[model samples]
Target: MIEYCLTVLGFVLAIVGRMDNLRGFVVLPKRWIVERFFAHLMRSRRLVRDFERSTTSAEAMIYWSMTMLMTRRLARQPPRRG
Candidate 1:
């Protein structure tokens, strides 16, 4: 049902499944990237709580948080010689 809704909204959903009979502490592909991004988002004070009254407002906060993260990463990189 959720997948159908997402498809209707033009979003492709990819489900990452766990390996069968896997050992303990196994890391799945692309999962860590999502986890790391959410960790970074949690660092923003505005995102720490559910203060937004609307979904749009919450999405805006996420965008703002990601922009800040990207800018900080860019600032730390050395300038490229042209």
Candidate 2:
């Protein structure tokens, strides 16, 4: 169902399966990146709850949250000496 929906929207969905043979606390490739991104989004108060009435509004909020996160990280970096 998910694959069909994404495919209709012109997206290619890649399923990242878990490694059953791995021991405790194993990080799957490309999965942690998604987890970390969601963790960052959770920091934003607006996103913590479903406040947006429309999907467009929610998407805009997510973009705004990511922008804020990136700008803050960039601000902390030292200036490059050219």
Candidate of highest TM-score? 2
Q: Give each model a TM-score.
A: 0.76, 0.78
Model 1 spans with C-alpha error above 4 angstroms? 2-6, 79-82
Residue range 1-82, candidate 1, lDDT tens digits: 6688687886777777888898889877699998898899899999999999999999999999999989999889698899
lDDT of each: 0.90, 0.91
Clashing pairs in 2: none
How much does candidate 2 score in TM-score? 0.78
Prediction 1 TM-score vs. true: 0.76
